[model samples]
Target: MAGTRRIVVIGAGGAGLAAALEAGRAGADVLLLEAAEQVGGATARAGGVVYASDTPVQKARGVQDSVDELINYYMTVSRHELEPRLLRASAEGTRQVIGWLEDLGITWNPDRLYIAGLEHKPRGHMPTGDTRGLGPAGGAMIVAALLTAVERADNVEIRTGTRCTSLLTGEDQVVVGVRTETGEEIPADAVILATGGFGAGTEMLRKYWPDAVRHGDWHWYLGPDTNIGDGVRMGLAAGGELRGRGGTLLETPNFGRLNDAFTPPWLIYVNKHGHRFVDETDTYCVMPHLIGRQPEGRCWAVFDDAALQKVADGGYVDPYGLGVDLESNWTAAMLRRQIEAGVVTSGATLAELAARTGIAAAGLEATAEQWNADVAGGRDTVFEKQGTLAPVSTAPFYAVELRPAIIGITFAGLRIDHEARVLDTAGRPIPGLFAGGEVVGGLDADVYAGGGTSIGNALVFGRTAARTATGGAA
Candidate 1:
């Protein structure tokens, strides 16, 4: 422990930053290398929410959430495809992970918000107030906080714009350091790969995540353009096995497509066959799975004046409103813009709207009649869309087309053990090497918990990897 324990952390994303900060705090000499000009990979574009069970915020809110419940939720959501040991470690260490963040001067907002349509107790936490941590338009608050901690750590050295091209292996094929793109080898006693997933790599995404790639809808929302699965490839080359090829991918209405990638509100989501498939209020996690199950792996969101008024009334748009200019906007204005721009079509009557949208006019009329009747009768028949304060029967209806919009975070990657070590084909840990965050694929295989499983697990296992790398108790 007294000697210099050189640890090289590749990729200065959330997991890399968390790992470097934890290792440096543990008195290990750390060097954090980032390939891009700035840090905060996908986190820079994230909503800064972290899912943790039984956190201090939850306790303050009198919410009864235990580690057992957390583990149960994870296993149930993922259908036990994840390693039981890793889930146990993540659940058992949730409190410590949150405590560690607090100790590192990261503040968590106490106001607990329920994720759209998830059945879990409230465990969603974020930084307080209007200070959205980092990146564009106050979206990356957690990244900003974590970057501050990483910069202030005396034992940590951060180097940006330095791409790690290959792993430096020594005798017995153990990773000793990393080789940069410029051919400079940064030696280390241990290495941790947190370079994220291949969401941006069109070739890899098309090959692996074909559903997301086929529709040209995936890989639209992301921060780090350089996160092209370097870590995943490097780990596999070094004898790591991959998993989670089939995971969830969200297909929300691209309201932002009208506004230059800024998310919009008041769009009606429909499947490829021009019909509402699943509950629009479902969690983003399951939405992708639902969308993927649809024909052509695509969906659309129809909007009109009535729907816009509903959005303006502060209904289902609260979650996405923060990132886009939806409120203080008019549906007529959007319709005019879309019609002029040739992106959307409109009509004066429901029959005209049905003709333009290729939906059966009789079915559309029947659906609207039934929906309005249900609203009046207090029950829906077709989709069972409860709490319908408004119906889509207004004149001059508008419709904005939508495909699956993948927000960079892929639910797939390499398989790893509880110690954060990548597993081989035989399910054994790869010696002297470790991975966490999106690099470890099986953590959220079949399904994902709504709130912030990505960021939470990234922090959890980053710290765990640090402990394991330092030969300390994990």
Candidate 2:
């Protein structure tokens, strides 16, 4: 609490980068430590969409969205579990975050498009142009921009391949700094943990929540292998309490489609009952919640020649025309392998497929018949599934088995106060220890909005934490 404050930020992901940049801008001597060789945890691999209400991007597009409406939408989706103060801060500060990014030379596209399920007005901001040339995920552009800003700022040191093993506590029980794997202790006046969540930590997932283990079959997309809940463990050891229970998990189709990358635009998803459970085009945030309600927390993608053709026409298929056919992708040999491993089942007829997959043959046939009929009638009766421009009546139906893949960025972590300080068991802020991003939970308890909840909250809280830690206006 003295002259030229020193700060240590653990993790080089989006939240960590944002926090470090803000603190450095505030004139704090900052050290950014990353466990992996590269920066950007899940953020680098994300779709690069930031949900910011009343942003200049939205204004440029003439979209009508306000902080009050954003708060209302969050409350409606969060089901009142999210703290009102935190929601207000996130809503109000999002504009500033966007502005700061723009000032840092990150360009945003002013396109207003609405995903069907979310209740908010169109206010999603995406990065301009195609970022595919940068990397597998468009997050490369975001991380590159932030890192560029960090480099230009004074008094900021970014050290890669340095792991923060533990927190350094002083006699007064305040976190002083962190001890790295090299047995070096970096000193600081304040410490921030932004190491993301427990997606790739299968062992931790089993230890904490054993029920989640059943869906372990679908952990094919291992995001940021280093994000093993180290931050969560460190915070808990420092006496921080975790919040947000009963969160959801999701299962996407096998990465076999998008050149073995985790691209979307799935053809169809079927449960263990061999029945289509959710609308494939639903928001990604809500899809996990829907998947949790199904049996075994698992599902499969069923598509055929016509549906694949439709995918090709809609540009959902590979744009480069990689010559990687889905038939080749979902071959009989591959299906046999999956079936032998108990991951998938196949058949020539719908009834046969249903029998092999252990689904009620009559029910599956009726579902398919009704679905085809709905396609013919241009209306879905049960799920009211929009975007039914293709039908699933082709022969030799293909089913690729899937289980819920828990991406890193847990909806549960340390509880924090309005100032972004970690809350104690008795609900008091722990001095000198601040947290944001997925490290601080309760933002997505019962409801999830799609546009930009994760990135928006990360930027908002990162800035707020910097302001609070440095005694600046938040």
Candidate 3:
């Protein structure tokens, strides 16, 4: 008895679920394997935004945009370090995926559409769905929709609590299936590796991303503990090559690992010498990078008693409420707790504060004077920070050392083409092999594109890989 095309999609995250649903809908038998007790991977913890352009969502919001414009912004922000062809694929695929996801019970509110990147356009399409307390709101909403669709699809079989240890190869160096840790081998006509980034893997971080290790013991990953570079390791053993570098690092005061990427704008950031280095309210995509370039590869956040009082008065939380909640580390309540515990350094004067925090006293005094002057004059002279400028002249000055140590997305992974087919060292696509999500590399450059670009890449390449492996039916 001949069966339908059997495809195995590994790692049941957004990318894996997308691949499984697409392949099953396209008439292929799909075996979706997940190592964790649950699906969703890191996508489940994201803010649930998909970056796109020139879609009905944008049109409904009365924002006119084009694929060309979107790619140009992406290239410009990445300093032209990305592959134009790959960016084109991502731009086009994400725009269409918005509609595809809509058909699967997800909703996009025109009012929720906002600018998510450094770009000057509104390309961040936020999906409206219920995570049912599963994970992060927006991303969990997306993963839930895809998971429901996959569950309803008759041809897709989901296997949880199963960890794939290696790849099964046949003659001609073609991948056939995956070998589980239990020595179980399930053969398939094709395999798509969707296991996510290596941010949580210690050895992988040491070898591939030392920038993360530079923070030493303070470094920690936000993704699930299961994202240990499984897909990349299996792909490498199967003759696939690696590409790309760097990852997303969010600045944190080590506030109990709550995934706080955005900070309140009421505080100003200064380097080791007590010099303002960047706009205090700059986007997180570039905030860590800017801080990394400072002396000692770190910075301190300075605030006056007034701002701390504002926090206590229930203000200064992340205005955007990034990643599904209004709470942040910048809350005055949290600050007071740390302050009482001596984690936050305080001084009665600028010179005293600088001395306590090891900052140059003269530089700190001069910078505070300039900041106060700029705020009074209603203009930021140096960085032109656009946030509400509160004078730092209030008594009991404070400084808290902040480091970009919370690892979010690891960018280095398996090399894949625009169609999501895994490529070997010689730049040839391996037969019956594909990948998606953070598992595929070369999509990011020196700086992260934006907030939603990661989840966008996951869904786009997941569907792309399934469609390619299923002969374009997906």
Candidate 4:
């Protein structure tokens, strides 16, 4: 034990667990630390979709994809803000990472689908299982598989409920170990930080990513509450450089929480001014930006009892087929509960509905009348929304006020290179220090590309960090 290489990995999420397993398999003395009682962090709550191009699965499905195309698409998505080396590494390593997960006994869903937010061709590989409320299922399934593999690794030891408070560095600025919250100093030969983002820390969010906080209210994060920037603090204290400091993946539905990327086409979304904006059925990524540009980053879904009844009957049409299936996604019972809680307000008339929801009565009445006319004409003349249309008629109209929510990935943390080595202010890697997962940013530097991008980044770079730290091929 004394002579063996000791590699300590902080956080037990997708990236940390993957790194620990890789290092353990490579015969390194690996120790995984987690602050929470559970092993899965935000990854457990994710949609479990991983993006990989030119995989064997693609060949089987008759889909032609190339790493070159992937790199081109990714560069466009990042707006050329990504490091060329890391971007290429991520794109090229995707198939390998997916194969690695398969070797670990994780089964991918048979359907190879194209996700909308990617702004590219279909390459998302979803794990097989039930998805989150509205979209790609089986994040928990992936977590379970990785956890099983980690448990079977002979050299890997996982210690949960142990929070890493700081990084232990030598006088030469090389990370040597981590300090636990309980005042225990565990020395190691190398350290990997994968402790996720600061979505839950209002103070940290205000200090580092203040733009997300609008009028003192940060948007809700759907990730694990445990993600509070512990790794960012430890890495920064050890002279790690921060990258993509102000980027985030936010999902704010104008209506109910289907948890999927589904926005009902039957309803009209209006800003505080009671005016419709955006093509309602646009991708979640596009919808949120349009909503965030509003006065208070808030919007409302206005519909009537007729549309509500159609929704309750599970017969409403989703033109783009982007969201969850109507029959299986949500229930009228859920809406009734929200209505009882006053989060979903209703009234008999547009004027009364505006009064209850604090919208301008004149604007609300006019928008509703015009929308009804547009529906009757089978055209969304204002937004050019090409799909089936419905009017907000009938008594007992309703309004569901919505704010932004984030769960996919937080994009503000320590910067790392293609090999997953954490860097300092001078752009040199801190010796023996590496990072991956959501803890290391720059992939989703500004706008998010798709659902699986974060998970792909975590798995691909987690293995990279582990292999390099263990003196194996990176």
**Among all candidates shown, the one with the greatest lDDT:** 3
Report the CA-based lDDT of candidate 1 relative to the real structure.
Answer: 0.69
What TM-score fits each model? 0.89, 0.87, 0.96, 0.88
Ranking by lDDT: 3, 4, 2, 1
> Which of the numbered candidates is closest to the native, going by highest TM-score?
3
- State the displacement of the C-alpha of residue 58, model 2, in Å, after optimal TM-score superposition: 2.2
Show how many residue pairs clash in every candidate, following the order shown: 5, 1, 2, 2
lDDT for predicted candidate 3 compared with the true structure: 0.88
Q: How many pairs of residues collide in model 4? A: 2
Clashing pairs in 4: 131-137, 134-260
Q: Which pairs clash (backbone N, Cα, C closer than 3 Å) in model 3?
A: 48-138, 48-139
Off by over 4 Å in 4: 1-3, 110-112, 118-120, 129-137, 215-219, 247-261, 313-330, 355-389, 405-408
lDDT of 2 by residue, 1-474 (tens): 359999888888778888999999898999999899988877776655677788777888778778998888888887787899888888888777787777766777665334423764766666543332434444556677788888898789999999888899997678888999889998888998888776667776776545455644545333578877788889988888988753444454453432222223335666766577777766656776676778876666766546644443322333112222223333335445555675655568878777776666776777677777877888767667665445668866656655555453466788887778888888987778898777778777654566456777777787778777877887
CA deviation > 4 Å runs, candidate 1:
129-133, 136-139, 217-219, 252-267, 271-275, 295-298, 309-335, 377-388
**What C-alpha root-mean-square deviation, in Å, does candidate 1 show against the real structure?**
3.5
Model 1 Cα lDDT, one tens digit per residue, 1-474: 468789999888788888898888788999999889888887666665677787787788778889888888888877777778888888777666677767655666555445422654877666432334345422355566677787888889999999888898888778888999999998888999888877777777777777666655423645467877889888888888878874445553344422122234224456534566765655666666777676766555565566655544332223432443322223445445556776676778867877887766775566566656765677556655544445667776766555555554776688888888877888887766888788778887656666567788888888888878877777
Q: Worst ten-residue run, lDDT, model 3?
A: 315-324
lDDT (10s digit) by residue, model 4, range 321-375: 3343333222466566667778789998988999988888898888988899998
List, residue by residue over 332-415, the lDDT tens digit for candidate 3. Answer: 778898899888899999999999999998888889999999999999999888767888999899999999999999989998
Q: What is the lDDT of residue 469 in candidate 2?
A: 80
